[model samples]
Target chain A: MMKIDVSLSKRLGDFDWQARFSAEGGQLGVFGPSGSGKSTLMNLLAGLLKPDSGHIRLDGSPIFESASSINLPPEKRRIGVVFQHAHLFPHMGVRRNLLYGFRRTPANERRIDTNDLIEALNLGPLLDRGVKRLSGGERQRVALGRTLLACPRLILMDEPLTGLDEGLKYQIIPYLKQVFNRFEIPYIFISHSLNEMRLMTDRVLEFAQGEMTGEVSSELLARRGMGTGQGGYSNLMEMGRLREDDGLYIYRWGGQEICLSNGGDQDTGMFEIMSKDITLFKRHPEASSARNMLQCRVVKVFEAGNRIGVELDCHGQRLMSQVVGSAVRDLGLEPGSAIIAVIKASAFRRLY
Target chain B: MFEFSPTDWQAISLSAQVAITATAVSLPFGFMAAYLLVFSRLPGKALLDSLINLPLVLPPVVVGYLLLLSLGSEGWLGAMLAKVGIRIIFTWKAAVIASMVVGFPLLVRSIRIGMEQIDDHLIQASRTLGAHWHDTLLSVILPLSGRAILAGASLMFARSLGEFGATIILAGNIPGVTQTIPLAIYDYTSTPGGDRMALGLCLVSIVLSFGVLVLNEGLVRRFRKGVK
Candidate 1:
């Protein structure tokens, strides 16, 4: 397994960031709000910035260490980086720019073929054209080809698609996927958009307030969560609503309560309960059909918006039910009424 | 109805020889100094920059006086070099040296700006491809800055051709030997009934200046087109 173990702490004017994380060989996406220290972390990894105090190791090889006094310059790091702006040299033709790195590599260590790169990037027609003549997408393609030709151990992409339009972003995302999959080299891709992260990465490291929260599987947030009232009552009740006091949310069911620790998103206090965990009942069933049933009145009903958000009220608490709109109307639910809310014991998960 | 003078032709040849020699001798030094100024974080950088540009601000005659103090026969370097049988005072070589001193600052400044304009990421890209500093400079930096180098060369050549004050001080005005076009024109204008000769040399100087300007423009245009 190719592993990256690094800890970087830096101070830029008034803002400060001290990030630490490790990942095995895979497509690791770094997601955060703007200026959340994503680019700074990448710069540190690429040897462009030296950490105030820490060590960076790639597969046990020391790239940087403050104690040992080992700090490799950017040129010696064997890390390839593609900037947001495709910084191709304007004076050189496309072929010359692409071959610049390839020509510098020692013959014995050079693994990539020049022709293969040209064909793969569809650069034959552009080879003779100067870089200033290339379109934005074309420039990025050449930049990617240039980075690939270098045979880097790790690739760092700093918002490679930030300025492109939606149509162009969609067009280039697939090509990026193909390149990443073909090389199978470890990549730390920086993106602010959650949708792009979902489509492009397998693992995501979230940054907020200058610290890495943790790595999360991309599948965790891929689909919308089933709200409170729509899904089976057992699941909804088990995944409790956000409590205002102490900022801790708890789901209680079947003599068990799970507490959720805060993981940075304090604003827009939203949490997701799984659809499969909710147990729906027709009436106010007593005696134990499920744990934690609320006498909720149906508020507004619509096609659960992704078949998941059915709004309802349970004892002055506004709740969302993830269910088919047909189910809401089938029960003849109307404003200001009473029904039983059944929540499963298992679907209560505390998001971090 | 054509009147041609052998002395006029001799002055033209001498000026051409001095300009060529000045440019040739100073080209490598200009490149090195310019590269250092752009890429190095050395101490006294601002002082060095001001020192290089001193000739452009000071009168050319003052520069000649300084050069003479250091290079003339009883002077520090001149006396030491005399021991090796190398005499530069009042010779054509001394004229070339005078031209070079005046022309160098422009060359270095232009080339240094060109080197600064190169996108630093391009150099980093070369390094990731396993290229060391030397290879990166050779394959990337030099080619990218070729137009700037050309522009600098043209300016240096033009400035060297027009150099008069320093050249006259270090190398005495001698027709067909050390005297260049500018000096020859001055020589003719001072003498009685030499107005036509002075006018001919003036026209030659104007033509040379115009040619260099056109060549510089053409090079810049071609480079811009290549970039596009």
Candidate 2:
């Protein structure tokens, strides 16, 4: 477990930022748009930048405090950073890059075994290859593996997946999830992507301008973001593996079999469907173009901006769907109202 | 066809010795200067930059004269070294010093270019990964700047081989002891009917310098391949 408590302020040119917050261990996220001082916050936490007059602590041990003029260098502070672009040493091979931090750390402080990290990150084949030879996804995995080998108390990722293309970005998520699952090290993920926030972080600290505007859970942040009208509320579902049939992948999701197109036969069966893509019918249509229809009852009706987000319970599984206020009135989307949600086979997008 | 004398052989050997010594001895200092220029936040950096580059802009003869003042017997640095019974004037060592001073700016410039191209995040990543500053320098910065260092060393070595104005002023044109290729060529050119020997030595100078340039080019290519 890890805990972070920081109250810091720094003025860069015309920008003034003051942030104070304390968070306990978990997949915490720093969510903000560009130029919002998120990188500055990361630098301060990693000891890469100094806070003008403030204190920063991890697990109750102070790493920086202006009152006593105590500022530990980044090396002294057991914090690791995975940058947006995988800054693997160009001169070293994958093995050496992975072992760099491990070698520098003392024997006693090292708790993570090298072999386990390599295996968890699936870096075995790429070990002998130079970092430049690896693809974009491969480089990121090596960067993460390298940082994990150092056994840092907390990892601060500054948009680690930003530069990767859409397919490559999500392709690395499972490796990241596997490493974090295999190792219990706490990490603070920083990104501007709300989809990434929902997938990776349980709690999020929102930043706007130069100050931290609010603290929110990832669920609330996702719900609050539904008002943007850009593909409202994405529902993440874990579909159990099944055999492919008739050019479509069949999977078990929420105690119901669902058909998905463009879902390749990868071991990772996680998929996401946008709330806007899910159409609701008061009664099952005798014939429809959409492939999967699941009978659901409205568990809650929450208001997100002008749109209404209908939370549904189907076979003890939760799914979110959004509709206009008029549609909600017409469909009678109240708690305990039975409705069938129609989803096209093409709507299911694989997460990883 | 040319007839070479034993003194010409001495000049040839001495030229290589002086150039090699100057390049080898100046490498560490050059690397540090490049590091300072590229990375350090020290005050008066601009002044240090100008001072190191002064010899590049100044005439070599003027550089030799200034160095003569600094290392002369009556000068402060020379006086301090004189207490240790180490005399450096009018010797092959003086030629080495002259070449080093003249060739330093080129070395530093090449290395600074390489160092500047390195991403700031790589260094930051190293520090956060539990590496000390020096550790990062040796492990990260050093290897990344390696190709540039080789290129710089080769440039300086070639420059030293053809060094004429400063070598003439500082080390003098003694036939065997202090005379190098350039000094010897000067002597041959001045003597009546010695143009053949001067032309022969000029060929040697071209071959030596061209060899260094080719070797440097090959090394840079290999380093780039290794990085890739």
Candidate 3:
């Protein structure tokens, strides 16, 4: 099993970044905001940057140890790195660059099929082309092919898709997923986008303020709050049920009830509630047509740009409401604030 | 009008020999110095850089004078060398030394730029492929920087062909031995009514320079295309 157990502390200007982690052969996605030290961790793992104090072990081999005075150069580490800019050798043709690592592979240990790799990456047409002539997406594809041809023990990618447009990202992400699935070689992918991480990562290490907070199974963590389904606000509408009392209708979710303005025969079955449609109030307001109002307590507050997401525990389930930061502060809302969450009946729609 | 003398042919042959010898002796040193400048993290890099470029700024006659003071017979180091029967003063070998000293900087600077321009990521990728340092240098670095090396060599060859001041200071005017193209041109121009001979030799030098420039341009263009 390919494993990495390394710690590094570096002081760059005003920022002190310290990282330590270990994992075996698996896809590990380093997810964090910009300037959170994700790329620094990858560089340390690749032996591109030496740690101030620590040891790095790859498999059973000691790649680096401060105590033993053993520091393997990047070329000796057998760790492949794909930069955000692709970093292909402009002086060599695509075929030459691809064959560069292949030629270095020892004859006795060489296992890569050059022709098969070329065909698999759709690089046949690009074999003879100059690296400078390839488009952005095309260059990244060739870079991936070049790294793969090396047959490295581990691959480190540093935000490879950060600069690409949406169309290019979409086109290349599927190919990346396919390559990762087909090859058992361990890969450490660094990305900032939640959507991209969800689609590609198997495991995730959350980074904040230059430290790794924790490791979580991408599937499980995503399912809890950010996943495609179950438990989160997006899935709450699916579990929602409508109940009529007198002329008013209430949407019953778990033990809490949200009264809606109208619940006619046209309204049917369980639906989903988008976090965007819900709003929080410091106290109950009188004379309102909106009927789905329930008492809840704030649990967590997350800030992204100009918006703040307020996590609330209503009844026995968690509900998230997106609100403006100004509004959140104006209401003097904190983690323990008792608030009313209002949602219109029209906001809850049945999910097919 | 086109009368050619045997001495002139001998001078041409001597010039070719001196130029080839200078390039052959200096190419390896140029590559090493260039690589060190490009890749090493040694302290006082700027000092070394300035020292390499010192010859470029100094008058060629001054450079030859320094070489003579150090390597000439009866000189400090020269006296020791003379005991070993290695006399360099006023000889054809001195001409090759002069040319090499004059051409070394041009070659090293060009090749250093080439080495510096290489993407470090390619080197890292090569290493991860299980290739050692030697293998990576040969397969990746050398091939990627081939054009720059060629450019350096070509510039050195052309510079060596045209060298004069240092060659004259070290290797005195000796026909069929140390007399190169520039010296031959000087000789013909100094003679009464030998303008035609001097013009013919001048034309040859022009053609050679033109040929090298064209070849350099072609190599660069081809390299650019290959990189793309």
Best-fitting candidate, measured by TM-score? 2
> Would you estimate the TM-scores of all the predictions?
0.75, 0.95, 0.74
Per-residue lDDT of model 3, residues B137-157, tens digit only: 777778777898888888888
Show model 3 residue runs off by greater than 4 Å: A91-96, A107-134, A208-352, B75-87, B192-196, B217-228
Q: Write the per-residue lDDT of candidate 2 for residues A1-352, one digit (tens) a residue.
A: 7888999999888988879999997679999999998999999999988888999988888999999898999999989899999999988889999999999999998999988888888889999997878898899899999999899999999999998999779878888887887788899999999888878888899999999998999988888888885999998988876878898888888679888887766754778899999999999999998889999999999888889999999989999999999998898779999999999999988877
DockQ (C-alpha based) per candidate is: 0.50, 0.83, 0.43
CA lDDT, candidate 3, residue B206: 88
The 10 consecutive residues of candidate 2 chain B with the worst lDDT sum are: B219-228
Residue B52 in candidate 1, Cα distance off native in Å: 1.1
Comparing candidate 2 with candidate 3, which one achieves the higher DockQ? 2
State which docking tier applies to candidate 2: high
The better-scoring model by TM-score among 2 and 3 is: 2
Q: Tell me what TM-score chain B of candidate 1 gets against the true chain B.
A: 0.95
Give each candidate's fraction of reference contacts reproduced.
0.69, 0.88, 0.76
- Cα lDDT tens digits, model 1, B24-132, are 8998888878877887778988898898889988899999999999998889999999999999979999999999999999989878877887777777666665677
